[model samples]
Target chain A: MRETGRPLLAWVGLAARLVTGIVWIVAGGLKITQPDASINAVRAYQLLPSSVAEVVGIALPATELVVGLALVLGVFTRGAAVMSAVLFAAFIVGISSVWARGIEIDCGCFGGGGTKAGAASAYPWEIARDTALLAASLLVASLRRTRLSLDSLLFATRPAERAATEGAMT
Target chain B: MSSNSKASARAQKAAEMRAAQNKREARRRILTIAGVLGVMVLIVGGSIGVSLLNKEDVKAAGAGSSEYGVTIGESDAPHSVVIYEDFLCPYCGQLERATRKDLARLAADGKVFVEYRPFDLLSSIADYPIRATNAFAVVLEKSGPDVAKKFHDLLYENQPSEQDPGSMTDDDLVKLAVEAGATEGDVRADIEGLAQQAWVDKATQEAADSGVKSTPTILLDGKVFQDGRTIQDMADNLMAELE
Candidate 1:
């Protein structure tokens, strides 16, 4: 039963990792390509002050790239997963604030794509996507040991083997 | 024989453990490399796609030497209007589309001489290699007035969304110039030389000196046109002054 479950768990982990990583990488790369546009989008939120927005605009994309790469590679997977969750949580909050204020503008997530005009909106959809991604990231972070990962191999080292090696060295 | 079998079993177990560890390590390395390469490919591919999608069309419009000082309307109809605009400004674009026909008619009649000075407002906000004014300066210097006017109209027509900020590239600017009637070589050389930039900077400083604070600032015979929101309002004011 454990053996059967192990492959299933690893497959699930792989799916989560790929989804989160691709989303982050695409989002980050888009922003980097149009840095000024990204900065303008951040400024439109008016959540952060000018100076802070400037710094955040410059650093956020690069940070996303690094975190996304680590998660996909399954190296420092837990740490990267946690960071991605936190970042998405912050983005959700920001989007919710703007939506609450009745500001009609695109979130600028998937580049220049804008929301439709009317009572119905894209804000809810954006928040929902981010929330779902956050959950998946948190799950991966908590379930640190997965098949085909460095962490699994490292933790799999046997205590008996370690003690035998120590005795031999002495 | 029993003791030998026990030793063989222990050795086999150790070997199996070592093989498992090696397999895991190999898989991990392969996955890592694949992930990194995938990311690099996405970034590079996405960037290229964006550049292609955002490519600007440059064409030089012909007004020839008369382009430099060519006035739009009546040369002596009693009013002279100069417009300072930034191509990236949404408001400027709006005004251009709304009032272009009227402005052209007024300029063609030689009654109102229209001068266009393209300036940049986002230069302070963003680090763009090609300033808004740079394109205008290039068109003005190389293509002449008629082409400059055409180029200016085309830019406003293709202005980026207000939510996004950035200027057109030099190549795109040159493409726009050629569409406006200036030779591609001349536009390229002028933009490359950066001489047009000097003219843009000087015009911008002069506009500031003349107390122009915002884009699409209209000056009538060296006087600011206050309250000229619409094209009709401007024409009415101009006619009223003449009457």
Candidate 2:
């Protein structure tokens, strides 16, 4: 129980949660506004069949919204972290595939606005961003007891028991 | 008891307390994780269902009809001019008006063919059906180029304001086609058939494949004409290519 040593990890966790949560929520909210555009985006990927593409388009945005909400609230931080990591990895792969085929198109990940050139199309930067977030999430998952967490307060050890045992032995 | 023993006891109790706390924290973490995962599954699953249900709506709305397809121009013409246009795009309407006389002269000489592909430039702002394109496809399929040209003129002539929802009902489309010299039965039948709808979708895909990202994209002999130039300029370019 190296409590004193864990604060730095917790801070990192907080930062990761905030960044990922905000991004997901914004991206998801944008997609929700234009579901058809989202669907077109999925179709552009050409990975999935049309039937599957439609379903993926709708579900992906909603998942982003829910996971983002959970992360922002600091409830289920570990779960949201994992979800965000997986989703980012998938997007990286999708973007990379399109880039490999020489398709010069937006990833539509941040809602069709942030399109860069060259290796940016391959989305190496995006993959790096997601990987860093995944590392932070994994750290939070490993270090489950942060100061402001409900788990920390509810699960605090009984100091009184330690004092009583010490007195009896003395 | 010895003081050292007492200290040992305290240390053990403290360790036990910490272990218990850790255990409880671990349980809570696990439970919260499970709960969030459950919600994620539900939400993702629900969205998939909604998307499938909305598929019909998207198709009915003609989400994929603005792409390029067959030239759909006059069969006897030596050269073809493909025009990609959007009903909401003022530039396309302007081109229609500006080039109307030149196009008519070419068509009258039977020396040039014109093909129309619908582009949805304002889909971001409004939910208008890709119907303008679909209507063109239907008219072209049923009543040929003359009727399509007429319907095209009428659409551009009666173009609605950019802010308003500019869609034509089946009846409205049919009436326009009738005015354009299409038989009532042909207009009714072509509009009713989903085949025309499919044609629009395929045409749109083709347009996208051809790297058309904007409205009023005019291609002469398969090469995009960035500057349509004047009618004379276009004719000169065509004559140069032919020679």
Alpha carbon lDDT of each predicted model: 0.63, 0.62
Candidate 1 error regions (>4 Å):
A1-7, A112-120, A154-156, A159-170, B1-243
User: iRMS of every model, one decimal?
Assistant: 10.7, 11.4
Please state the Cα-based DockQ of model 1 relative to the true two-chain complex.
0.05
For candidate 1, write residues B1-243 as lDDT tens digits: 699999999999999998996787578667855775587567545554554444322211211112222356645656666666666655466567766777677666655666666665546444332354676667776677678778777777777654454445667777877888989977787775676666666656655555454555666666555344233454455555533
Predicted structure with the largest lDDT when compared to the true one: 1
The per-prediction tally of clashing pairs is: 33, 5
How far in Å is the alpha carbon of B202 misplaced in model 2? 21
lDDT of 1 at B152: 73
What value of lDDT does candidate 1 attain over all alpha carbons? 0.63
Candidate 2 CAPRI grade: incorrect
How many clashes would you count in candidate 2? Answer: 5
